[model samples]
Target: MAAPGFLEADGRNMSRATVLMLMAPFFALVIFAFLYPLANLLSISVLEPQPTLEHYQRVAENPVYARVLFRTLQIALLVSLLSLALSLPVAVLMANSRGPKAIFLTACILLPFWSSVLVRTAAWAILLQRNGIINQTLQFIGITDEPVRLLYTQGAVVVAMTHVLMPFMVLPIYGALRNIPADYSRAAAICGAGPLRTFWEVTLPLAMPGIIGGFILVFLTALGYFITPALLGSPQEMMIATLISQQMRENLDWPFAAALVGVLTLIVTVITLAFSKVFRFERMLGGRV
Candidate 1:
């Protein structure tokens, strides 16, 4: 009854419209639940009562806040470097191994992730305290006349965070290493390259992408870490998250707290974008994805 092909075309158009309608709720939910809340939080940095940049100015002007920010960066840098250093050999071994050895190594990397962060932090607190296992062992062996102060230190926070985050570094690097073709290394050897030379010239460059990705991931997480530092370190070692929490809950300063979060978010966003731009080589880094 309709014009030639017109009815079929109309039917196709109607189907497309129906599909779009079905997808609308999902889009709405994403905007409302995630994007909207993030936008609101960011707004707090500049928008209070009316709108002003005073909050950001205060953060920049305050020596204490500035010092904390620097400390945050320092801790993040150390954690990222340490995590990379520790993860590489483990990743290499995991990539090379098979059967039970591979399974055991992988399990070790994943075991800590099975436990809650709070539980891990608490465990460290007990183990690192003055009367804790390490101190007691030292005292028993006559290493010290008294239990040394191992807990409530920056070193303690760094150690706990490194232990907690080592897996993140390992998995990415391991995936990358495993994705590398064995033939490349074999070819290098056939070309009369020594073991160290082949690895340095071939494997290391290829593995760089994974290394950088893992570095960024560890750094970002360490930047935002709260529980380990809070539990293991003194007040002076407080990180940004702890500071934000103190401002919001203890001081009842939502705007300032939100501003702190906003600043941290900005720093992370900038770093991530920059890293992505500079390290498009991540795809070449093997299986880091």
Candidate 2:
């Protein structure tokens, strides 16, 4: 017969083992679906007819490819900034308001998410095209003598991307704001703090984790984006995604396209890791670590 304490310890160990057994399938799926495919793609970049540094050299040395990479970064930065700026106020309003106002705002935020991204991009293309609705409306109002070129421009691409990505920025910020306790602001007011001061000093700092999270999500997603830029942009505005497509489809260069994919993946992975580190720091400072 076992001592009571010895039996209790055995039961605890079995419970821990059971938990691991339950988690095994999830870990296996992640390895197979995510890591394996990514490893295969990265291999394509280097595994040529023979192992080569040539593709990476071509990407770095060629002015055209370098310019395209630079353009993609620029566009991603602009979209991320614009998305953050636009999302903040909407997030604040949703957090503060109640009743019908809150319901309407939340619905508006989620409306775009329910629709297909492809459909949204196509709609923007029609709206912004030279002979499309926006141009026609402007011409009809005598705002311009001619239909101004709007579609197939970098500006149009940014505008459409910002629209699609705005929801991503807003949701996280709202979550952060809602998590902030109400009494902190009330106590500040009681202590003679103005509303603006209280918000700036207390509310903003507390909600920063969410803001940073939203920024990273929007920035990374925008970086890998393909369809919006492809449809809404010109050759001069071509992003990395379009370049990869051109290589694979038109140039019939799978290895080179894979190299482009590898570069993009590396950049995104680094950015995500950096963001995760920053988030951990923020959480520690906020006492939530």
Candidate 3:
């Protein structure tokens, strides 16, 4: 008979091989679909036109590109913060409620997802236009003498983006809040802590993982956001994605557009790394280390 140790080793090897075989299709898809396209983008950015760095140099030197990049970061941060603020109360409500109340709240939150993003944005345009419902309501209420220029402004872009992204923030936070044992809060109350104090001290810290995850999700999605900003914002309010689209389509500057993409990709990589280092992402996603 084979030695027990040798038999155990052989079984382990077979298990490892089976796992790898199961994962082969996923790895192949990632390589061809994602890594290959990214490699092409990086190559075109620097290797096109005889290995020149002038494309990147122009992006660095140009004031327009810098402004747009800064604006994109600003808008993304704003949207993330706004989404967090709006989501917290709703998440709390959902976490604490049960039965029909929970169902109703969930339905309200999910109602927006049934529609396309373009349709949602167009709805905002109708509500914010000069003679639209919002302006008319304000006029009827005597808040303003005439129609306000609500559409095609930075505020409009921020508001619409916040509304669109709020669901992403709410769901993560709700999950986090729901996972906390009811005993913890009861323990706090027994320890003479008021409701507000118990929530601030016990509840918030436990729910932080969800909050961070939500913030990162909203911020990253907003960074590459195109349609909402494009429709609602003016030329002066253009974000980096819009600039990249203009460069690619209107100017037909493929290499330059690739360089712009390279810059944005670098920024995203840096931000993701920084967040990972500062927080335990495994915990944030409710996984054990």
Candidate 4:
């Protein structure tokens, strides 16, 4: 018979092999669906037209591309901040409430997801139009002599994007807050900590993981947003996504577009790595790193 130690090691190896076998299909799908397309994009950026780096050079040289990229980053960051600020209170409410209140809050957050993004964006456009409900209300309340230019502006783009992405921020935060035991807060209170002090010292730190995760989700989504920005923003407010769309459709410059995508991909990868390092995400998720 095999030794006990050897038998246990063999069993562990078999389990590992079985797990890998089970995951093989998922790995294959990810490779074909995501990695293959991404590799093709990178190859096109340099390898097309006799392996020239002109597309990347052009992107580096062009101030216009830089401006669009900066604007995209700015908007994405702004949306993430706004979503975090708005989500905190709502998530807290959802976590603290019971029964009908929690259910209602959850339903409200989820209701928007049931509707299409285009429809939600269109609703914003209608509300923000020169003579639309918001402007009309402003005029009625004597806040302005004329209709304000709320639509086709950077603010409108930001606002609409924040509305659409708020759920992503809220849900993760709610999960984190919900997971926190009530006894933790009670323990803090018993230790002579006021509500504010308890929250500041205990709650916020514990919720950092969810906050970071939500911010990442919102920021990344905003980075590639197309419809809301296109519908609500002017040419001056064009983002990197709009620039890419323009290159692909109107300019028909596939190589240049691929270069743009490669740059964005690089930035995203860098940011993700930086956040992972700085935040120690595994620790946040209660894992040993």
Candidate 5:
């Protein structure tokens, strides 16, 4: 038989054990579902064709893969920048407004997310097709006499991607802006800084973390985006993701495909770490503010 104190301790231990047991499924899911596959891909990249470095050497030597990788980074960077430009004003408007107006503005930004990605891409395709509604409307309104080619281009991909990614950019920045004290702006005004100056100096600095976070988020996601670019862009504008799919499916080269995945993973990790380091430095400067 146990003493009263011993019994209570045992009960507490059991309770803690029960909580941990409840969380085991999540741990297992991450380990098996996500981590296992990643490990397999990494191993496959190196171990294929008798554990040689030939695949990586080929990737480095080949201009086609190099070009696709470059194009992917370029497109991703462009999309992120465009998303930032479009999201800042919207986030500011939402962060400042209140009640029904703020709600309406927020809904407008979030409404597109409720729909399917395929649905959104299809809609854009229809709108941008040579004889689609946009061209027809343009002709009707006398913007252009002839239907112009718009369906498959780099610009079309960027526009559709920006539309999809805008909310990711907006929400983080909005949260950052909302957290900033109104007093900062008030003080700026007292110090003789006009609205533009206040924005450029005081507000923008404080909001940098969120803007950086949003940019990184959109930028990284755009890097792996297959469907949007596949649908909206042509072969000349093909991205790394599409190339990876082509390698695995069309070419039936698992080793090379795995190498592509490995390279992409490395690139993403480097970029994310670089951004995280920047964020941490800014936080040090911020100091509990």
Candidate 6:
């Protein structure tokens, strides 16, 4: 009895409602798994043990906590920068190359994703040991006669973290580079720009979004990184995450641990918002707001 247009409109409304129905589970999961837990933790930090800001105040006032936080930031920054430096040229190469080389390179980059982080950290532990391959290689190459104590240092932590986080940096950059048009490079060449000049001007600027994305990804992931650093780093290099775990599990100071978690969450939120404000994350991902 309804007009044809009216039936089509009804069908569209049903389709929209169906889509919402499909999405309902995902929203429910987020609420239960992420938001609810975070809210509970934050509330515990403030409300547990007679409702106090004392937990937060202790974290701020303690020099050890302050040092650990600062050290965590330092290590994260170092790993992010190192990953970016190593990723860019590889990303460019992957975007430009073809045949088996590209496939092989991509597999090499992606293969690590299939492995567990614990396994990777264990491998690094073996390789960087006093008599391990790297030290032996160094000895063979006359870099050092005896083992140089490489296993449990800040440098070792950064090296392992960079390797683990490198894929994150490379993939975003590769995606960004792949999205850039070939004509842009060609146009620069036609405009009498050399290869390096064209890259420095056209390619680099165009790829900034990806670079920024990769940097943030690597940086943020490195911030709370626990396994690699815990395995590789010494007590002197203990990061905020390590401290938080100790507080929660070893010390059994739930309220203080909750407070540390709150602080870390706040820092992460502020950094994420700051980065989003400074850069167009959607633009980098080739999308529009």
Among all candidates shown, the one with the greatest lDDT: 3
Better of 3 and 6 by lDDT: 3
TM-score of each: 0.87, 0.89, 0.91, 0.91, 0.88, 0.92
Question: Candidate 4 residues 99-189, lDDT tens each?
Answer: 9998899999999999999999999999999889999999999999999899999999999999999999998788888777888899999
Error of 6 at 8 (Å): 9.9
Clashing pairs in 5: none
Flag regions of model 1 displaced more than 4 Å: 1-30, 281-289
Q: After superposition, how far is residue 205 of candidate 4 from its true place, in Å?
A: 0.7
Give the alpha carbon lDDT tens digit for every residue of 150-219 in model 2. Answer: 9899999999999999999998888888888999999999999999999999999998888887888888
Candidate 6 versus truth, CA RMSD in Å, comes to 3.4
Alpha carbon deviation, residue 243, candidate 1 (Å): 0.3
Whole-model lDDT, model 5 = 0.88
**Of the pair 2 and 4, which is ahead by TM-score?**
4
Task: Tell me the spans in candidate 3 whose CA falls farther than 4 Å from its real position.
Answer: 1-22, 286-289
Encode model 6's per-residue lDDT on 118-218: one tens digit a residue: 99999999999998999999999998888889999999999999999999999888888888889898999999999999999988888888888889888
**Cα-based lDDT at residue 233, candidate 3:** 95
Each candidate's clash count: 0, 0, 0, 0, 0, 0
lDDT for residue 285 in candidate 4, whole number 0-100: 43
Tens digits of per-residue lDDT, candidate 1, 59-124, equal: 999999988998989988888888888999999999999999999999998998889999998999
lDDT of 3 by residue, 75-104 (tens): 999999999999999999999999999999
lDDT, residue 195, model 4: 93
Q: Alpha carbon lDDT of residue 269, candidate 2?
A: 83
How well does candidate 1 score on lDDT at residue 268? 93
